[model samples]
Target: MPNSSEHPCRITIGDDGPLLVEGPVEVTCADGTVAVSDRFVVALCMCRRSRMYPWCDTSHRRRTQPGEKSRRDTG
Candidate 1:
């Protein structure tokens, strides 16, 4: 998790894929590591294909086409 001073950000799960995280957040990994960024807004990788894990690499787009199998159990 990011520092509380960062003010945090809002993450919205798109209907397709790719979580949209908007600014002021300090996104952290499973190990409690935080991402270094000078900016506020950032798009995180939810599909787990990003060379920059936790950041969007557009892999989700490939997994979610018009008629592809949905791997995520949103429920």
Candidate 2:
């Protein structure tokens, strides 16, 4: 069987931020490792630049391109 199972999960997408997921959520790695998060909310990394994989650590706020703007600037 798979290490993890699907269930009803709430998700919120931002125009220029992490994907917010309502937790307690469990995540399993491809190598058979598992990580559990019990926070009321968990932010999933979208820009793939987070040092914390599968989680948001505010890395997305950093400048990525010469003219890139943050959500604060656009919104």
Candidate 3:
């Protein structure tokens, strides 16, 4: 079987933030790695700007200084 989500999960998407998943949840990365969280809720990084890769640390909220361009703005 193809390696992908086979079951359903309740995920909440933000306009410019991480995906919120109610925990405890288990996640499998594209690299064949896995991560889990037993917290009441989990924030999965969508911007990939998090130091906590796979998990969000509100890094997406970081603002670039004047004259500095952000990655998302470049695309």
Candidate 4:
């Protein structure tokens, strides 16, 4: 059940990846470009490497570079 006093938003930190947020969420960039999502849940990138800005596409689970280490999944 959800609490009515709070906005319909929540964030969950991934073990080795993005921050998952319950939405609809609206992201506005520095240039004033806005991105909107009505998804039930949205993954926001933490590694700054996602092809889709303001959204996670599992890019954080991959190696940072060739020969680099990959992140381990703890959950």
Candidate 5:
């Protein structure tokens, strides 16, 4: 895992998709709702099609069909 003092949480990009986040982490939604779990390690969905919000449900794999890059580049 890449080490960075600025970001205490450790995040790894998985080969199959989903961001694997480990250690102290907090997730906040646009509606001011927050999800915090201690030693929080979980797979988060990069694709916005999850029925279970904020978590990966393997929806990305289906979404990224032929001619799709499975890229969710947001700024």
Candidate 6:
């Protein structure tokens, strides 16, 4: 459901990361599934490694330098 808005939604792209989308987004997956979020902003997973699927669980941050901590799943 969508209502008339004065401002259009905004979407941002990074060189290497998930997509940054404006608040309260609804995304339709390839399987005809719908993913929804109510946060002020949402990071849509670009990498298919997210455990949360369309939502980003920071699983894309597997590349860490030496001595740096990795955000990849450890559990």
Question: Per-residue error at 8 for model 2, in Å?
Answer: 5.3
| Top-scoring candidate (TM-score) | 6
Better of 2 and 4 by TM-score: 4
Cα lDDT tens digits, model 4, 1-75, are: 242555645779867788888777888866898999888888888888889977887887645565567555335
Residue 4 lDDT (model 4): 53
How far in Å is the alpha carbon of 57 misplaced in model 5? Answer: 1.6
Cα lDDT of model 1 by residue, 23-60, tens digit: 64567799998985545567778778788877776776
Q: What TM value does model 4 have?
A: 0.68
TM-score of each candidate structure, all chains considered together: 0.56, 0.63, 0.68, 0.68, 0.57, 0.71
User: What C-alpha lDDT do the candidate models reach, one value each?
Assistant: 0.69, 0.76, 0.82, 0.76, 0.71, 0.82
Can you tell me which runs of candidate 5 are displaced by over 4 Å?
1-8, 63-75
Candidate 5 is scored at a TM of 0.57
Error of 4 at 3 (Å): 8.1
| Candidate 6 local lDDT, residue 57 | 88
Residue 60 miss distance in model 5 (angstroms) = 1.2
Candidate 6 C-alpha lDDT tens digits along 3-65: 347666777999877999887887999999998888878999899899998988888865767
TM-score, predicted candidate 1 vs. hidden true structure = 0.56
lDDT of 1: 0.69
Instruction: Estimate the Cα RMSD of every predicted model relative to the unseen true structure.
Output: 8.4, 6.7, 8.5, 5.3, 8.9, 4.3
lDDT winner between candidates 2 and 6? 6
lDDT of 5 by residue, 1-75 (tens): 234787566779967768888845568977887876554577777877887767777788644466667565342
Sort the candidates on TM-score, descending order.
Answer: 6, 3, 4, 2, 5, 1
- Model 3, residue 42: distance off in Å is 0.2
lDDT of 3 by residue, 5-51 (tens): 77445679979899998788778988988998888779999998889
lDDT of 5 at 17: 68
Give the clash count for each candidate: 4, 0, 0, 0, 0, 0
- What RMSD value applies to candidate 3? 8.5
Tell me the spans in candidate 4 whose CA falls farther than 4 Å from its real position: 1-3, 6-8, 64-75
- Model 2 global lDDT (CA atoms, 0 to 1): 0.76
Which of candidates 1 and 6 reaches a greater TM-score? 6
